[model samples]
Every structure is written in structure tokens, then in C-alpha cells.
Target: MAGVAVAAIPDDIAETHKGIVQLFSSTDDQRSVRESGQAIAALDESTKARHLEMQQSIKELTGVTNRMLDELNDRKSNLLDPTTKRELLAQKSRAEDNIRRMQEDNASLQNQVGALSNKATDLTTSEQQIKQREINEVKRAKHTISLYANISSIKWDYSSPNVKGWITAGAASTGRMRAFEMERGSHSDFQVVNHLWNLMDSV
Candidate 1:
């Protein structure tokens, strides 16, 4: 039966078996990782641009406020009538109000920039976490594939029909098989077991 089953495998399938294994072993998270990196970079660029824009706005507003204060000082020092002095006082009050409003706006912009920076930091951290998870998953997959390869290499001597003898022959072999079984059963998603079964079925 085993010989017949082996014979039943198509030549094309046997030829491509290694390719199929490679396909299954390839990490699916690579594209996600790349996309996450790109997103993070774009976000960082956007944050930087916004910060620069805020800084420019603050600089320009400060220059305008300074010029207004200088003009007020010059007017206060000049010889002026009562009506002109009252107008100067009103102008000063308006300028003070404008400066206070600009200060509030500057503070708000600073807060917004801070929030954007924090958000970018969070995204970067999340990306790093995702990469770490992918690395761990790849390691697990490699270990599982190695275990499967070891299990497949064990020869069964059906002619003598000594299952217990075969199992007991090597402690290392038994340990590896037990470890493989335990690993297979420990998956929460059952995806690893299903993947292994699929690989076996294809073989």
C-alpha cells in the first residue's frame, strides 16, 4: 500500500515539492511589515512638516508683535495732543489683546505638535512590536519545520512489525517525537497543526 501510494504521486508534484515547502515556509507578514514601515515614515514626515510650519508661524507672529510694540513706544515718546494720546492708548490696548491671542494660538500649536510627536512615537513602537512578533513567529515556524523533517526521516520497519521496539529504540528520537506532538497540540489557533497536516498530505 505504501509503495502504491508513493507510486501514485505525480512526477510534477514530486518535482515541485521543495517549491511548495518554500512557499509554505515563507513569512506572510513581510508585506505588512513593509507597509507599516512606510506608514510610519509618512507619519513622521507629516509631523515634521507640521512642526516646522507651526514654528514659522510663531516666528512671524513674534516679529509682527515686536514691530507693533516698537511703533507704540515711538508714538509714546513723540509730542502728541490729548486726542492723539487717547488714540495711542487704545492702540496699545488692542496690541496687548492681539499679543495675548497670539500667545494662546502659539501655545495651542505647540500642544498640537506635541500630540503629533507622541502619536508618531506610538506608531513606531507598534511597528517594532509587530516586527518582534513576526520574528518570533518565524522562529517557531522554523523549529516546527525542523521537527517535522526529523519525524519524516524515521524509518518504519513494517516487516518485523515492532512498533514498541521502534519507539523505545532511541530516547532522543522519542523525545523529539514527544516534543513535536506537544508543540502541535499547544497551538491556540490550530493553524500550525493544520499546516503540518497539509504539508504531509501534499507529500
Candidate 2:
């Protein structure tokens, strides 16, 4: 037995198939994606605005050049004298120079904007680090307070040689008084206490 051949789909069926493929597409999803992209674009709106302004300026320069050419063409039709034609050409040359200067200024403005954006990012990072440090300091203070409260309940042996060091250690740990001896430049818990004592004594 021979197998039947397959036939090509008609144009109407193909068009209907294309419509069916898009039938399940969600407008809400497309709108959400577009809004997300626009939010990202808004973050760089300042830079985009500057670039747009520069582009507009270049467009204006082009317009000026075209107008000058049109004016020259009109003057040629009027059969103006050579002196007047020379003056118009000089004006055109000045307009060209202005365009070049505007382009250079645009480049400079872009560089300045980049520098400012970088500086802002650096400052933001620094601010966050400072805030984290402050939060850590507060947490440390609270921990010290809880530790002291628990340790104060204990009846320490003042007669024991090994336990005698607890006097200074306990004072430093509780943040009540500073330790007398320095411990290098480590800035550890005990070392900070020693530094505070040094500052007080110096004053």
C-alpha cells in the first residue's frame, strides 16, 4: 500500500495559526516588562537628558547649515554680486566652526557627568559603611551591658592569685573603667580600654 502525500497549508490557515500563537499572549505581562525597563531607564534620565540636548543642538546646527545653503542658492538665483556671495560664504564658515565648538563642549559635559556619577556612588558606599559601623557599635554596647549583668551575680574569689586579674578585666568588660596597660595597636576589647585611659591621663 502507498502512503498519501501531505499537502501545504492554505494562506488562510497560516494566518489563523499566527493569530492562535499570539492568542495566549498576556498584555499585562508585556506592560509589566515595559514598566520595569522604563524604571531602569529613569535611573539614568539625567545622562539621557544631556545626550538628548546635545543631539538636539547638533540637529539645530544641521538645520542652520541647510538654511545657509538654501539662502546661498536663493542668492545665486538672484544673481548677487561677488562681494555679497563672499560674505555669505564667510558666515557659513563661522557656523561650521560653531558646530565644532558645540561638539567639543558636549564631550566635556559628558566627562563631567561621568565623574559626578562616580563620586555620588562612592559617597553612597561610604555612607552605608558608616551607618553599618554605628549599628555594630550599638550592638556591642548592648552585649557588654548584658554580659556585665550576668557576671555581677557571681561571687568572685579575691584571694586567689589567678582570679585577681578579674578585677581589671571585669571593669574593662563592663565599660566602667579603663585598663592601665596598653596591648600593642590591635584595638581589641582590652586595647581600646587602655587607649581610653591614656587619653584621660593626658588630658
Candidate with best TM-score: 1
Specify the poorest-scoring 10-residue window by lDDT in model 2.
161-170
> TM-scores for all candidates?
0.39, 0.37
- Candidate 2 root-mean-square deviation in Å: 32.7
* Candidate 2 C-alpha lDDT tens digits along 2-38: 2223344469855764554355344447665566556
lDDT of 2 at 113: 100
Residue range 1-203, candidate 1, lDDT tens digits: 01111124357754565454455447586665566556655765686677667667777787888899999987777636687788889999999999999999999999999999999999999999999997898678657755755665433243442221111224444333312233432454356546445544443
lDDT of 1: 0.60
Top candidate (lDDT): 1
Off by over 4 Å in 2: 1-80, 152-203
